[model samples]
Target chain A: MNKPSVFDDFYSVIPAGGIGSRLWPLSRADAPKFLHDLTGSGKTLLRDTWDRLVPLSGVDRIMVVTGRAHRAAVEEQLPDLLDPNVVLESEPKDSSAAIGLAAAILLRREPNVIVGSFAADHVIKDMRGFRRAVAEGVAAARAGYIATIGITPTDPAIGFGYIQCGDPLSIAGAPNAVTVRSFVEKPDLETAERYLAGGDHLWNGGMFIAKADVLLEQLGKAEPALLAGLTELAEAWDTPRRGAVVDRVWPGLTKVAIDYTVAEPAAAAGKLVVIPGDFDWDDVGDFASIAKLHSGGRKSDLAILGENARVLADASTGVVISQSGRLISLIGVTDIVVVDTPDALLVTTTANAQRVKSVVDALKLSGRDDVL
Target chain B: MNKPSVFDDFYSVIPAGGIGSRLWPLSRADAPKFLHDLTGSGKTLLRDTWDRLVPLSGVDRIMVVTGRAHRAAVEEQLPDLLDPNVVLESEPKDSSAAIGLAAAILLRREPNVIVGSFAADHVIKDMRGFRRAVAEGVAAARAGYIATIGITPTDPAIGFGYIQCGDPLSIAGAPNAVTVRSFVEKPDLETAERYLAGGDHLWNGGMFIAKADVLLEQLGKAEPALLAGLTELAEAWDTPRRGAVVDRVWPGLTKVAIDYTVAEPAAAAGKLVVIPGDFDWDDVGDFASIAKLHSGGRKSDLAILGENARVLADASTGVVISQSGRLISLIGVTDIVVVDTPDALLVTTTANAQRVKSVVDALKLSGRDDVL
Candidate 1:
């Protein structure tokens, strides 16, 4: 099978560090979101993502970069990748700081090797399509380009920030690639609907592929001090106390998202390329978003038992995920969402789902880990 | 303290032998409604009634007349009442026949003693008031008259039939005595409201106190054959072959309520005397009525909790009776009745509480005795 491949010596650094609080109750600080079996089936999101990456590289070729807090979990999740090679951040830092560190560390060992970064907590249903995108990303990275797979808009999904692709990259027999125009922040309903209808904006899947050399050179050009510090730190990675050395050098690092640190600036530099991807993808942000991914809005519109029991059953109103232990009988509940964990239950309207974070915030302010 | 002593020389015979499909999922052939601990206070209605009657009578004076199927449970409930004298029924006979039998049998031992016949599944609050009423009933019976303590009307409670007192008996020094004008059938809300306003009508509390001689004489005047056969059987009650003899004689008895068979006729004949009872009482005919007895009313309610987790908040508009071992939370329910037993739960608006019998009818047709 003449499958397309990434740059010959590429490193896929999957970041699994973020202590995602938006998916609270189900996801906890001690056991983060990536570890949850959201599907109700046994496999976790990180496990699925790791399996997707395995065919492209060997044990040493793939490196996972996570927080020091998550190193043991990462080792346990991907046993084959557990070694001195895997990078654990000294202190919890922004994604770009970790990304820059991974790039600098990998470049020293395989100077020509490409770098691919992925968020660990994502669901990509179309693995074959994703594999093809990875192969395309590796090719682009070899050509000294920063490559990001932008998913074709399926809905006016406002949960994700979008990327606007400018023109198609024409290469016969190759998957259609595009030159990216500009990044778009997460939009309101009207803007998201316009992006969906306009057919240019794509969901930014947070999976980027670029060569280690290109990433370093760009960092040097864009943030020379940050690049210098990461390089110095990577040089002593295998020396005495690698993490301790990085911890000593970490205080001066800038705190910013990778999108803000590099992707936004690099896209403005005219070298950023976007490839059209047909993969069924999700970042799985919160309970509301995770619910959508679980059913995919494709089939299974949940209908609680009705009629015989007095209830306000208007389909347009809201979805209720209430405290119906083994069996939940919903009566007279209208336009509300109810989610029951073994402990606390969450009840609000779907219109207020995004603001459910405020509930968590209030709960945290009240010092209620028992609820959140 | 000279507390006016209320004597239960009167045997409290709860006639639960009839096939009560009206109380399905609770009153089954094997385990009737009287067997269930509906109070959720670790006491069955029969047991609660028995306890209530304890202050009034000796253990021998408390008999539960149930079917052959419920003998074991009845015995189990009152291990003390299992001394053969506490349970009496003619293998699931109708109330008329059971009452006929009750009168004849009790007369053999306590020939001139008053027997107060009551149902087991009724709920009574204001125990002090109930005790005073029972005392009034005992006093009225002592004066050579058949006495039935009638509850003063609080509303036009259409669920119960009513009695209109003609006038005071013109007796000197009688504080709460009345002559029976006639018994009224259950009426509509307008009629019931009027009855409450008139201050002369009483809800037939289904509690009757009369000398065994008076009850037998009334039975003789009405169903002479039933009364005569039962009298003949009464002489042979302590005989070894009593069950076989009862089987032979009981089939000849007609299926009629005691009110229709004797009480109404005697009242029509101007021989019935009424004594107004001051007691917080309920027949607990359905789950809805049963709930009100717990919560008091919608305005003033009570809660049932477990291990600090409140299981139910009972109200007049709605009541929740929970089975132990599960957490229950009810929201926004009004005028609804909820009975949660181990096997199944019943949820119905109390307005349709009379139609709750329809649910029982359906269960009976489906042959779901496990639920019952």
Candidate 2:
């Protein structure tokens, strides 16, 4: 008999739908973060995510769950994406509905298949390390445990949640797997510093892996109504009635993230495991994150990203994303963030990057939806 | 006999040629600062200068000396400006060549005309006080002295040159006129503070008034070659050979400022008078001046200037000049200056406003003159 591949029957599901308001004027309502090449890799984040998972799940086993508005863009970015493997949400019903529906559909196609949910707008530098962690997480999933790839904390980052690990799990092919003690929300600076020093807490990057049936079972245990609704939609997803069913059911689905619906409850029940991922990862959360990702920790460096971006910087250190094809000139500005798009521009300091969302909120309040 | 207006025989000469590089992106080589409406008023600075001088020098007596490249724009801005009164230089030959040529031309047109050289880009908030100061300076000019309106020092501003005054002049309708001991260069901060404290110094605002013959005489004494070249151009100005003479003599003319060619030498000769201008005046030299001009001394106020500029600023104190019709959003930034044009954008602190010229220089060095 031929030896089986480690990624046998593994499926990758990408949930790509977030405006990423902190990255405003670049990531708009029609074009979200996943549609952008934030890493200067000459590929959209969604395309990068698809490429990252192709080695493990193969091209045919990958599925994308995104807003109906972004269907054409996602397809354009990932032309190899199959018609049947794409799930379009009529509207945003949160991560629970998006992930659970994908899981239910995958289970219907093959009950024993393993499904891994990965965000479409994240950046992972070390592909070898990322693949190794995913393989270990898949091994844990095959052992009847919902697995999460917890990133090793490199700094005291208060922007992300923490995953606390307990005793180690000795699953076959997954020696680094450990029982997840709990899933904690984003902590304060002191708590984050303690978490970084403790060595038992890893950043919760929201990469979840599990058997299709196992994820559905965990969803059922946590929110039965949400699971039932997702199951109903999944049954009709492969049929011509997919449109009618989604339009009728998506708006009424529960709005909750997978961390609350599955990871938190599964951890409480001792059915979740965390595989340590020592790879570099980032959600591209804000300009500050982009600055850090591109600067390579050089505080005095200016990070500029765009295909036709013409930047002239002198004695300045900052992040400048120019999508407008205009020349961006910076002088003696330190730690500033300048995002120039076609219709809007954003200027702020890296320390106030998170407050960019308030600008979007104010725009929305003023009914300036054309730019948004 | 009919009573004469105070402005009778008084003509205004606007030397409008500097690129104002420190206000870059908004102020380009083709479209310099004088063409921009930096005050958020409905008129450009050149037009404002015309309006301000109309009450002192009637529309028929106001003359504009600018580069030939900007002749069309200057005419469009001031349609009431007579064609014969506008002197178009084939190339920039500095303030002395521009103002001296205009003086030589006015002397040829009418011998006794008292010509006042007012910068086309300075901001004067108090029109009454400005006219009062100009009338006093003109009175001193009628008394055969080269007269300049020295602005009252409001702060220890090192950005402006100081005009040291000595003894009072007894010219009628000009009680505030004093003998200019010397015209000093821009001083260091300590020297500027001492000049401010000594009460014997005033800011040399470059508002010089003199008879056309007197100005030409001073220019002949200081720079005879420049005066001779300007006199030749002026002799041919109203003839059909105007363009030929300008083309032949403009580039060969001396490149010097009026301060060096006339004011300083006249001060040394004990034939210069300084009229103390208590009006609020600003040269609009840089973004810091723009911030101070628009913010009205309110440190925390965000000053936005553009007709179609849609701005959303929160907890930000700075100046934003948006000419691109884009939505500019600022968050948690202090003392920042953002200039958004259609082809280029600039971001810097008000403290580094003067350094913006370095960015323009860099662009020029890189052969990006298309944007410049």
Candidate 3:
């Protein structure tokens, strides 16, 4: 059911503290994946996400939560985001800590403020469906139940974690929301296939909409140390010594995702319910995701020839990316990913793009960022 | 016998009238292989050949015989050779026509002169041995015999024609002079291997040294029409309208290789003599010849990678030349050639190098000189 957008003070909690090392050269310490225009279409993922978020939330209400190091990059791309609302984590904390910090900041300002905890670097295909799910979650959060939006599983994707559905929720007026049975980490290929076959599982994409107080309460009960540090960091945010204060506390926290610290435990207690959204959401964790977003339905008709061609594949030939966009005329290349960066190149079968991160990890260990 | 340096009037005859479609872009109509520093080295083939010829022939006596189209390129490279002796044919009329033309020119003024026919684009390794052979041929030519400097056979190379050696001629007063032998066209792979194993076979390198009058007599009997045309062309060459004179008679002469009309026929008639020259000689007709010249003995060791590559190859995966001299690195490339030139590129295996000329022919048929 479509619902009209209604929020007193809509807040955006853009978590950009994590280093997207998986994206490498395009997502370096200087300019993360969210800041770079990977599509070559000029609009960066972060900027596009902001453009989508700003229309729903007024310009003054928008906040970009990031690390102190990324302030300049975030500021450069998003001039529309309020400088005071652009909250920096006292240190490089996990996503759960960042969410807690955003929750503490917005709850102190407005008791029922809908804090949208969105990723800065995802490519969402259906904005309307996404907004509808977000609106439903925001509405649900105000009613004291924590809400998360999950994407309908289309493939047996082993890279993504799965959220199993329980019985339909008893919440009034929101029939589409379901009680979450459990949160599963990235499944094995066999489990992923079964999930695809079972049809009750949705990919646990990192998207959430909740009232600041509900999330803070969940954070306090699920991860108390994270909640306390987040409260102190949120209060100290924007102060001259806030970065130093957050940095000291950040290293002490366990590096855990929100699902492990809150959603899984909250589901066990029967408090976490997810709204199944067919918004075509993707975390864009690897070349495979990028290929899906780019291929649309034309995956079979694409032929990319170059040095560093990050292409997705099926049973046929794959893609090639060459350096400097040089003329990559392939006569005999097939079913293989050909990556040509300036310093190095990679050629492997499409079934192995998941292992491409192994190359990235090797590059990091080998200290070949000049190539990475 | 390494004889005295005196009593030898060394006059070099550079044969530049052969069509080099095999070399393609690097050996185009305007700036053939002789004019290029293909190895990225400072000196060109013509420059290197001339450097070697200058000390033996004295820069004053070094003459180049090329087609009119390539005359300017040759003269431009060796401006000092632009004297009356630098012969330029209006059209490529093969080595038979070229040698006859040189013979007629040298006959009038330089009596007992030793004319050494040298290709401007062949790659030879051992310059000292080559000079020794030429000096020996010059001494032999003074004693009256049609002399061919034969390369010591290294392998069963089907790419080159072979010469059968006979008993050495007793020079009487001279040593290291050989008499009448036989010449054979490029045999099949099996025949070449057998020839290599049988011994007494030499690579019939196009290099020849002989007295002007002796060459005149041989051409008169071997190819009468070519010999007469050369005599007429040389006579008219002293006149003001030499270009028109040569072009008028050029179409009348038979277009045949020097091996067929002179070397083979002369050998079959029991008049062909050869002197063994111990030099690493290669015609450099295709990539196999080029591979031998590269220090690593293969272009595979000299790879440059690029993300985007446009190459002009002499063979299928043979010699890759990129148009942009920019860095081009190949990651998982093997047994392939990549080349880049400003106008064109080729990508093919070295196995298909001989068929590289087919690319030019295809372009010509398609009316694409822009790429050809």
Evaluated with DockQ, which candidate comes out highest? Answer: 2
Candidate 3 lDDT tens digits, A1-372: 122456555577788765565443334565577875544446888888887777567677777888778888888888877767887655666788777777887777777687878888877757788877777776677666778888998888987888999888766545688889888889999999999999899998777777777777777787788788777776776568776876787678756677777777777888778989887877767555555555664656334533344222223345554444332333233443444444333444445556655555666686756554
lDDT of each: 0.67, 0.90, 0.68
Please give the distance, in angstroms, between residue A351's alpha carbon in candidate 1 and its true position after superposition.
7.3
TM-score of each: 0.60, 0.95, 0.63
Better of 1 and 2 by DockQ: 2
Per-residue lDDT of candidate 2, residues A62-140 (tens digit) = 9999988999999999999999888888889889999999999999989899999999999998999999999999899
Model 1 residue B134 CA deviation (Å) reads 7.8
| Better model by lDDT: candidate 2 vs candidate 3 | 2
Tens-digit lDDT string for candidate 1 (A1-372):
122343357677887877666665446666677886655446777887787776776556677877777778778888888586587776677877788888888888777878889888888877789878877877777676788888988889878889998877653323566788988888999999999999998999887788877776766677777777888888998688676767777778776678876777778887678877888888877655655654547333332321222222222223333223322223333343444444543434444456656556666786766554
Model 3 residue A96 distance off true place after TM-score fit, in angstroms: 8.0
* Clash pairs for candidate 2: none
Q: Could you give the fnat of all candidates in order?
A: 0.00, 0.95, 0.05
Ranking by lDDT: 2, 3, 1
Q: Is the docking of candidate 2 incorrect, acceptable, medium or high quality?
A: high
Compute the lDDT of residue A251 as modeled in candidate 2: 84
Select the stronger candidate by TM-score from 2 and 3. Answer: 2
Writing each residue's lDDT as its tens digit, candidate 1 over B1-372 gives 122244735566666554344443345566666776655667887888877876676666766677666778777887767465644564555777776677777888787677887787777757887777766666666675667778987756777888888777743323576778888887988999999998889998878777888878887888888787888778788778787877787777667788876778878887677878877777767655665656656534533422333242212245555543443434333565444434444445555556656655555576754454
